[model samples]
Target chain A: MKIKTFLAFVGPSVLAMVGLIAVPLIGVVYLSFHSSYVKTEIVEVKSSVPLFGGLTKTTVEKVPQPVLDENGEPVKVWEYVGGRNFDTVADPGGLVAAVSKDRSTTEDGQPTSFRQRMDGLYRDVTDIDFWGALEFTLLYAFITTPCILVLGFLLAVLVNSVVQWIRGPLIFATLLPFIITPVVGSLSIYWLFLDNALVASLLEQFGAGKIYFLKDAISIRTLIVLYGVWHVTPFAFVILYAGLQTVPQDALQAAMVDGATYWQRIRYIIIPHLRALFSFIILIHLMDAYRIFEPVLVFGSNLFANSLQYLTYYILNFEDNYYKAAASAILTVIGICILLLPVLRRTYREQKGVA
Target chain B: MAMTRDEKFWEGMRWAGFGATFLFMAFPIFWMILTSFKVARDAYSTKVFFSPTLNNFISIFQDPYNFGPLLFNSVVVSFSTVAVAIPAATCAAYAFSRYQFKGKNALMVSVLSSQFVPPVVVVLPFFILFKNLHLLDTRLALVILNLSFVLPFAVWMIKGFIDALPPDIESAAVVDGCNRFQVLRHITLPLIMPGVVTSAVFGFIQSWNEFLFALILTNQKAVTLTVGLMGLHTDKGILWEHMAAASMLIMIPIFAISFTIREYFISGLTMGAVK
Candidate 1:
């Protein structure tokens, strides 16, 4: 009876998840393997109109359109004659050979091996959307994660006080950066580096000329990494601050009485006590950061700072390339899963005991 | 909490640091507000002082931008998501919290892990599905997409809250000839109302701030405020003052909501992490 009732209670949620998320995800994988195809279809066209003659012009013609299936559906039809979409992205020229410089020394003045030619091809390749995006994604994740941890720790420690006079407003102030839309929040940072803005003016005052931070690829990437740290630190600060409250005061007092400085007490008692909290924070941050998107949009770094998520959007929106988009989306999902494996393992271990 | 001479020095230094940190934190918002009020000619200048005008606000609400529909869409989408997701999440959360069914752990783990899947991956299938159904540019699409993220978060958070409620009340109602439905309606719902509200607010904000899915799913008619802010970037370069005004309008309500619900904010965000 309880089992029947439980299913009734939970049925809607499970149904919704299975319908939207699970089914679509499976569809993503299925669709990724099949590329779009255009099949010429014969069609009958008839038209009548009054023309120069009183007989009224009449036209009948057979035209060709893309073929539809039995259900009048296009079926994507699986095309690779133009090019395999996924290969153009994830494995561009994977099976091809090309030389760099065309001047490499050889007795016959020709490249000797496909392996050498491929190596030179790789050297000559300056940027590709999929690979650059992956690079930016990892760089953003690694740099921002540590920055949030350290900066959030400082903010937490800075504001964690017995004095209530200033804590309230300070907490509210810190929350502003986080509470804004991610697009607008990143834009706020991006705008500051534009010419005639305050930050740019400050740079000019300090013997630097007018500079737009979004101009260069490196600066664009730097702004994104910096924007990420600025945006995510509030979350870390809030979590760590909550964790700090859980520390036992007597332990800290005992350490203080034993001649431990504030730093020493925090290093020994506080950090050790808050280790679980740190792991939880890290887990949340890792999952969120690995799927980073909107910041790249505001940073205007389409040329260099595209994240994997951004690349997925780019593939579909600009390329009109659904086949490759599905493949990239699947690749991104795999990347997220790999990143979260350790966190998932820990959660599974804990849940086993709960069970 | 006793203070010594050395500790006093550190305390003073700490307050000073917080003062600086507070300024750093608040400066962008200060500038945003400052720009919103600045006259157009003075917007690009570095001068801190200028005569202010409210024309930017009124002008943005005029033609070509038409932010009114976008704001309406944001409200409807966010509220509709919370409305749907909250009840569904509550039902699931209650089940997870109250029962020990087989594979309960597995179910919970799967639900929680879904939260980590990037919106882009999710958006891919949604884009195709919505295109076929002619659901694009409708508030329903945003609500449905919002539910994918907000549902997992809401379920986890609501479950955590429900977990803290005492079992005695539920069991007592059950003993008093109450069916599971009756017990949930009579005894459980009232007890967990605060959690439900907190979860609702969190879900609301998640949908409100959601960018990727909305950007892809809606072109003009059902655009949310988060995307509408982008429309301010015209060919004549970004209208800094106009964006500032639009942004302030975008942020103020969420700020008000966050401030009012400030107490439960962290607990809701971290979900079970704090416990």
Candidate 2:
């Protein structure tokens, strides 16, 4: 292909990507350091009140009102506030103060030891909203990654061992959870655990007391992680199952002849065979679990637990401040890049080799 | 081969695991389908038996919970996004596969890296831009915003398919007095038609299932089905059966499309990573 031809074919997509993605990324970074506000001024007005007779009384009060242009839209002012939005969103000073205060003394003002100081550091970091959200998001990603991989591998093995006729239905059953819309999937699970719903009622029927699963931080976080694993494990299963079809049957036969146990074969042959797919799943899962937004909304877990994406969203939508939201969003992006650095480097090397 | 006692034990365990896995994976969906048909009173219970009714579905489509417009918006937005993304992606994928152009690797790497950017980063600026342009709450806004992720995905997926092709057919067409355009149109397009369709379906699902962009960019006139789920949270409390019914509406089309393309779905998902 000529260079012109290649450019002609690729131009539109490159343009769209640059216009939509690259430009917006730069804009987000720019907005993080600046804020737009409606210009306002204090104005006083007096209104007369009629008495019973012809006399009247007047009073004046001042109020801050947005200054409008000739077009009647509010006049806007743009100002740069370096790191203020970041500070507002992260509360870093508060975090440092909390940690230092703990380092010096206990709550009752006694001197603290190293272990106690470490414990207080942990508490202080989590108490700050941004650090707490990062902790939960990372924990969710790490916990769900292994669970999904193991369960998914086991599922692949079971499906591979099953009769051919049942495999289709089994795949269908597994794909339902994976393919269902995330919000709907999370909502379905959330409905079952509601106080009067099926799961809660079943627990009570089995002699447990009434439990408010959604009310507590621990249970809600657990449910969120469970939802993550349940929703994503099928994806891993499908990919690994595809990998399984390529595993050499002769190697398995040799293992069987050598009196290898099932677990031993899985540990030695199947795992090493599917190692690439494992990393693929982990890479995708980490990227996704960091942006765990819909479940946080559907499960109403924001009051108890917030993912980094959810915090950005809460600031963007509920607080309706783009600057702070952009600051939070930039931090979230940095976190993902850090989390994915190793996998991404490995992938880049492999792609370069292939090229 | 005949099964020994140990083999029999392992087979039994496999069956048990299969059963457990099936129940865990399918039960929530089954419960969803079941509740969508149940009366409001029975929906909150744990009973396996209930007098089911279609009234919940009927009610959701009427009055304040008018899902008809939402359904329309979702279909329009998703289809428009795929229609726009697939062609652009196919062209780019072909270029990347067939040509060794300058800066190709840099461009490809940038495309791939953009996929991992947290969506909120892009959405924040788009939100502000769309607000300034008064494009909020329009299906067009959604279609354009969705391309940020969908185009990259479609490019990588379709490129995977193109790379797998041998290129012999295109060379033959070129030797037989075909220009590059004619060769691509006559030969390569037909060869990669299945890939194109697969990418289309995958892109459609991504667009349909998208939540965050639609959530922030839309309010009233252009709510997609996924965002429309929020409507079920009424002040009277979430009407469970009604919500179930609405969820079915959101899920049924995706379920249908996925089942038909089950074979391609896995390949499309792993195409970027594997290749």
Q: How well does candidate 2 score on lDDT at residue A55?
A: 92
TM-score (all chains, Cα) for each model: 0.89, 0.94
Error of 1 at B233 (Å): 1.8
lDDT of 2 by residue, A162-276 (tens): 7899887788779788889999999988988888788988889899989889988899999999899999999999888888988888999999999999889988998898887
Stretches of candidate 1 above 4 Å error? A41-85, A92-126, A353-355, B1-9
Q: Put down candidate 1 lDDT per residue, B1-275, tens digits, no spaces.
A: 78999989977997788778777677777888888998888887777888889999888878877888888999999999999999989988888889976787888889988887777777788888899999999999888888888888888888988888888878777878999888877798898888899999988888889888888999978988889898788989899999988888888888989899877776676667666
**lDDT of every model, 2 decimals:** 0.81, 0.88
- Chain B, model 1, TM-score against the native? 0.94
- Please give, as one word, the docking class of candidate 2: medium
Tens-digit lDDT track of model 2 for B1-275: 89999989978987888889888999998999999999977888887788888898888889989999999999999999999999999998998889985666666777888899888888888888888999999999999999999999899888888888988868888878897778778888898888899999989989999999999999999998898887788888999899999999989999999889877877776676554
Kindly list the per-residue Cα lDDT of model 1 for residues A90-192, writing each as its tens digit. 7656323322245354567765586766555554443656766877788888889888989888998877864778766667679888877787787677767
**Which candidate number would show the highest DockQ if scored against the true structure?**
2
RMSD of each: 5.0, 2.7
- Lowest summed lDDT across 10 adjacent residues in model 1 chain A is found at A94-103
